[model samples]
Target: MNSGLSKRKAFLQSQKNQGHRITFGFAGIADFRSFIGQEYIAGMLKAASDYDLNFINFAGAIKYSFFDDIDFIARYFKTFRFMKKPLIDGLVTWTSSFCELTDVKRVEDTFNSIKPLPMVDIGYLDLPGIPSVRIDNEYSISILMKHLVIDHKYRKFAFIGSETSSPHLERLKCYGQELQKYGIQELENSVFLLKEMNSADIAAAVNKMLSCHDIRDKKEIHCIVTPSDLIASSVIEELDKHGISVPKDVAVTGFNNQYSGVFARSPVTTMNLEYFKRGYAAVELLIDRIMAPKEHFDTLLVPTSLLIRQSCGCFEQSILEAAEAISNSEEPAFSLSTKEDFRPFILEKLRQIFPNLNKNKLLTLADSIFDDIQGQKKESEILRYFQSLLQDLRKEGLFVNSEVQQKLTLLRKTILSFLPDPQKNQMENIFHQLRILASVFIEYDTIAPREDSYLMNTLSQIAINFASAKSGRQIQDVLRYQLGEMGIPGIILSLSENMTSDLGSTSLELILPEPPADIQKKLPFKITDPAFIPKFFFPQGRRYSFMVEILHHEDKYFGFTFLEIGNPNISIYDTVRTLLSNALNTVYLREGRSKKRTMLLTGEELKGILNLSEDDSSEVHNGLKASEITGYLLEHLSEMTDLDKMARELSVSKSHLVRRAKELTGYTIQTMHEKLKIEQAKKLLQVESLKLGEIASRLGFQNQNYFSSVFKKNTGMSPRAWAKRYLH
Candidate 1:
């Protein structure tokens, strides 16, 4: 076996013996800066952290012009070659991201090359054997259709979305199924599936929908359903321009409760396809596969919720009304009309909102509320208990004022109904007091959004800082300066000259706030850990949640950046990633120029040592002629470390080449190679300004220490001492 492969196996074995976490690889063809990308990555990180395992995300995009070049795409895709056994134990592929650029068969083929590692597909495409974790588009569409048809009494409906998206197509099929179920025949012209989603295409679709007035019904379409919220909002705007009022002239609904749906002018009625649940379910499925390789698993279906709002021709459910419904369910657990049965009902309702809330704590809370309702607890004591519970939930980042008010209101209304007729008036006054207290608590305790101008200014400053970075160190400085404002707790930066070609030599460049001293010593470390993070780097108590994102510009694979994401606004992370990649590329180019100059000078100096003229440049030779062995030795210093390979390349016996090189250069072949490397190092130190570690790397030394030892052995001084004396 090759030395590098042997070393990697040994390293992995050692890590395994130390009982390291099982590492899972997540591959996605999406830029992390996008809304979908950010949510998926964040969800995966959260889920993995909960399991106390490891997740390494390998992400890139092929949709944009910058990533259009074939060579660049090839190189970027090559980064996935590292997602194999001994590096990651299981895999999750975001297949949906492949819909536009490629198909499922191609994606399966790409991953099949690295098999025996269990895999999970997180997308719409159903790979034959690989279990998929995706949102139930059919169920979500059915819910929306039922609400629109049965509740709103909308008879005719039109559909709008892109043809490229799998989920959209699935939703379209379900929409047709629902129409048939309701006995409302859809017109052929009503289904407008575009090649792509753009303003012009959507405008054209809207025009076509309006012009088609069915003579059978003699009525315009009652509603339009779309696969995406953005498209739905655009349709609403276009319809309005033609004097059609939403839910009046023509109602509209959208899929995915994205910001465009929630904050759209008309507030689109849509389905909330919770991406976090998608991410969490994906990891669970992947882990199950890893643990039971021979067992078959079904495709995991993540649930979605239908959100009612104005665009659907209906008013949104108010907090009070929602509370009333929860308190009046016919189901046994939710028949919360008496104190004797309220505990289970309250706990169940809260559990739906906070799934991870402690069961014992929830029971205690239920009892406390019951005590207050029975008049066994003082008013001040009841208020204190509510305040404490709310405060704890707030710190956990789980408190939402509207949701909290809804739950509290449900509790209040249920207790008033259970009281005797004579006590009803007295109990209603107590409930009124509780309502006032909740309002005051919510007003004072709600987390406020950060100032818009401050965020904008901070982002602007971050961009400027990145633009000004001229070196890797300067880029690190920029991160240190801006991580706090950006809400990133820590960062680990690794860099490679060419990640696909030289992954084994990729350097762990920096770790923020510094890891422990032992971990710090592992800098300039290769990716020997299966997790792609050094073991023990994250303490068990810390619960560090992070995602690994590629650092590259198109085909130029620089390295990976592992970011700790705590901020809800993910746009900033994408901005930082873009600027950082550009900055690193700029530094890479700068270093390339310096290396060219240094290599040129070293080549000339090597010829002088061999007593050869410039016209006899070693690069000009095709083969290692007997007399030109010294030239060959100097030309191929880096590859000469593998003697057997070198001999095969030269079409000569190893012993003969070694004897010939010694005869020509008056030193052994290996010794001559070392001498030449030292000569190049001396010139680089004297003529150029570079770090010792960089000089070592440029000369192909294993590390700075080995380079120093070789230099000292041949030069009678350390490299630093020689540089200090000669440069001056």
Candidate 2:
């Protein structure tokens, strides 16, 4: 905040009885679930300043349906419930997201009740009750049109955009107005709006455009205009598929100059709408109106700049060039102050750059920037400080000549505000302050996507490691090394023995950051147990950990990954679990399941289940090791039909046998016996002499229908169907 606001806050603090606490309701899409919409957050924060804020986070346009009255009513009611808070004094909202997809009459009642809360809308003006801060589409589009007509001498063009609502219509209208002024009328087939927001939609639109026009002819459509860089990049990609070079075959330009526009092989020349300024202005307008209710509402217009890039045939041009030139262009003959003087000053400067940023978060950002400077001299460090601030500022808006002047004025006013008393001569110091900040910052920004190759490589390496993992110890070592390479400090892999069915009693099978002593003990529990969940928030440490079920092909191959506990990057964690799940699936299919058949029971239960006779010896009480038990079963495989006699011979319970079998092998004893019997039945089913009744009797089923039902349930087909399909 500027010194004026600081002074006002100080004064307000002193007036305890007046209750100067201001709560500004910021309504828009800052919800992390709608990750694509966070571009609004930067602008919202700048305009919000130091006020106590409440974010409604309503993405009604994207979340709610337009036609269903019941859906509209329920969601609108739920979203607007924030308005019921008695202390909310004013509202700043993205009207386009609010009004476009919702019934105005349904939402009208909510706004009407809060008519006294001075409100300002951003992005669109469709909402009737509130004043808005919008992009100057006519002025913005006119710049591009004039540039194309005069400088490039282009004639025919196509406008590609959505026809959704007011904002979209405004851009289209601006295009028409510019064409009218130049005496260039659009051809009947020049407009393209596929009414979808995907790259495929834009590709289809471009294909349709090409089908109608002959790009080979010089008089045909020479350029494609779009609503956003996303559409423009998609159109370029689609055009590339058809072997058409951008600007060579058809020039392309887009609005919003967003990061997604970088995919265009030829960079898209786009319009910068200064969304931060718009966001700031909306808050200011709302605050001003709240302080003093005006007889009339005002619409604030934030300016837009044209970025000349490769797609419009401007290969030599750059991003934010003017702001950058001033950074190094001017050699400051004088410095501000000493190290002590600069540190506090630098801290305050960042507060302005990241206005409305959380206090702790703002401090954290300052620490990072300061660390980069590393105690340099005030002269160079202050310039670095100003350069960083300007770079952040340019993200909000392209600082052109006029926009630069507005910024200078803001700094000058702020400087004058907090002075207890000052002479006119202090104007020189203020000018010096403005000059330092006026310097531009130029640096190439890199967007290293996380959903790129590094993640894929990490998964591939993990799978390769798992393939070579012959034992439990190797599985641990492979996992630790593989995940560590991906900057993952911690991991926990949970897999149930019986993954072929529903994962009920699964637990933390493997966990890092522990004593090796804990690894030997079994920690199996139900999946519903709290121990399965890892902690999510740990601000004191850089490390994080999250656990997600690994689902590959089916829940049968289920597991979970916990990485860097308490990390906020949910997207990365989600992707890692999925990759791990897939890698595990690949390894499982290649090497097959662990092939373990150890009875999951105590020594007593295994002995009781086996019903071993006196002649079996005292060693019968030994644990049900997979090798020992499977070897014994193979030895006496044929004489195991007399269940009661076997129980009587060893004085072991029959129920214990059934329970132990399922727990260890993921099958009931009866089912295990049935599986063995099915192998015999398959041989009999193929025999020309053995009837269906004889087959059922041989499998220990008294009725043929009972055998058929069990066969269908277990094998997903009747005995006849199974025999016909597999035998043939």
Candidate 3:
């Protein structure tokens, strides 16, 4: 029975042991506090929890003094040791930069002294029994060099790195080895080791390199290999500030394929080291080692790959070659094929002559050329011919003069014209080919002819003739013939300038008798007012004025027009004056009593009637006519006595005199004082708060009651009400 109990107890103990959990601590979490890091940490925790493991994460920021603080490291290590358990699985230390100041011996010593249960270093340190996961700096640097040499064909190279890191050391070693393989000497002076390079420091370093007499004299420094993409971008910026161009003056290659490199002025060519995968794999390896400490330790080497971009000027050639091959092939393959079989051979040949050609654009051009040649000739024969031509061109070199562009343009036009139904397609394919070629070979410029040329004149004349015809059917006929001659099948005239400024009021106008069916489907603007003009002007503040008259004759409509060009404000005044003068001339030309002229008829007559001389006639005409007319009437008030009776006798409305009086004298005609019996009546009524009956009696009213009622009706109030409100 005791033996049976012992077996049961042992079984229970085994179950408890199986339930045991391992905890992990992550150091320097602050350094890895980005979106990528957060995701990685979450994954790490999930994995640990699944494996019945516990984790204790640590974050020690090395922002300022903490960078060189040995005490901080010692204290953190002590705390970790205290928290560690006898059954602790293992510890992993993750850091971005190297931890050891001196050598691997110092790193090992530091680890042994700490004695944090069982620990591992996962950064840039080689601890004795600890497993590590780090970037394959040597392989990555080699890949970078290959991109620079084989891809970009850059010879003069400079490397930027941090001196206090294992990655830099490994990268330097590999960089030297690769240079030796290419029969190039690795110069010590070319390598720039920055302790903590900021913008100013980076700029200074780049300027020094660029200004160095030896480097400038030897050959143009074509490429710079950097340890970090961020550093490489900074170098590009600095070079630009100094008036030096990237990829043009110097190409740049960087390690660590970062997103920033993609968005930089020149996208950098970088190595993809699989940083996150490396970290995860490192954790898994460290955990396994902890579970079985006596197990044989192993190191994992992650492979690196290249992401080529403008900075290195490498991948463009490959794209060009692929395009060329596709173009030249008889039966063009659609599926992606092997890089070797589909390499950009045409681009490679082109680069032999145009060494500075951008790889991406070159590849695009080659593809276009390939498409152009496809199905046009025997594949084998064309290939042979292309090869021989490329060889000859390379020997002669690409010497593109102005005539070359013109010839290319002519060739493109000819080819487009020969295509099946060229008008229908507009030779879109041919245009694309020409554009690609121009973009690669020519500097930035507009290939289309300017608008002020003979071509534009011909187009304008054709459009004008079509618009001016009387019959809609006639207009269409004229347009079809004219446009067909010019090789234009269809055109929609949206807007046009009728005449040049300085044409004055004699502008040519185009009238569309029958607008296209499509235009009828769209919304229309105001088209009715006879005097309404469509304004046209030059860009540099020259105003051109014109009015269009739509003529309807039979079933056709034509545009009749006149234009005036001058200063806007001046022209408006001049136009009004001209109309008034013409009216006056018409009145003078009339010869009958039925003409029924007034004293205020002529501008000159009105000026004389106002007693103003001829010198002021223009000012009187341009100024308010109503004021001058009122002044003339006031001057002739005695002659025009009995205004109400005179107004009726003159055949003018009473309201007309009131309105004209207000406009000229700034008062109603009733308010005008004529020094008559009404003035004496008003003076007698100006007593303080006088009763209406008393005021009426004093004003010599025949009946006080009738006078009070008349006064009240005229003033819109009783005398008492007015006196109460306004009397002092």
Over 1-728, each residue of candidate 1 has an lDDT whose tens digit, in order, gives 76633543454446456776667878877643345665777688877776666666676643332224455335545556457655578888876676556655556556654556798987776666789887888899999999988998888778889997767888898888888888998876889988778889999988887677532232667788998998999888887787766766777899887666755667799998888788877887787777668999998888899989888878656544744664684533223356567777667765765566688877776677667656665564446666787777778877776777676666555545545555556555665566556555554442122112125678778878898988788999998878888887778777764423222234577888678788778676654222334445554434454555666565455667777656754444545666787788788887772222212224456656765445543433344553455544544443326577557546678887777666445677677778787886776675333578866765668889989999999999999999899877
Cα lDDT of model 2 by residue, 584-628, tens digit: 555555556634221122234334434433333333342443324
In terms of lDDT, model 1 sits at: 0.68
- Candidate 3: regions farther than 4 A off: 1-17, 32-56, 60-83, 86-88, 95-116, 213-219, 296-298, 315-728
Q: For candidate 1, which ten residues in a row score worst on lDDT?
A: 445-454
Give the Cα lDDT of each candidate. Answer: 0.68, 0.55, 0.46
C-alpha RMSD by candidate, in order: 13.6, 22.7, 35.0
Mark the 10 consecutive residues where model 2 has the least summed lDDT: 536-545
What TM-score goes with each of the models?
Answer: 0.58, 0.43, 0.39
lDDT by residue (tens digit), candidate 3, 462-532 = 54564455443454466446634443323222111121111111112222333335434331222111111
Error of 1 at 644 (Å): 30
Best of the two (1, 2) by TM-score: 1
lDDT rank order = 1, 2, 3
Clashing pairs in 2: 323-440, 327-440, 536-566, 544-564, 544-565, 545-564, 545-565, 545-566, 550-559
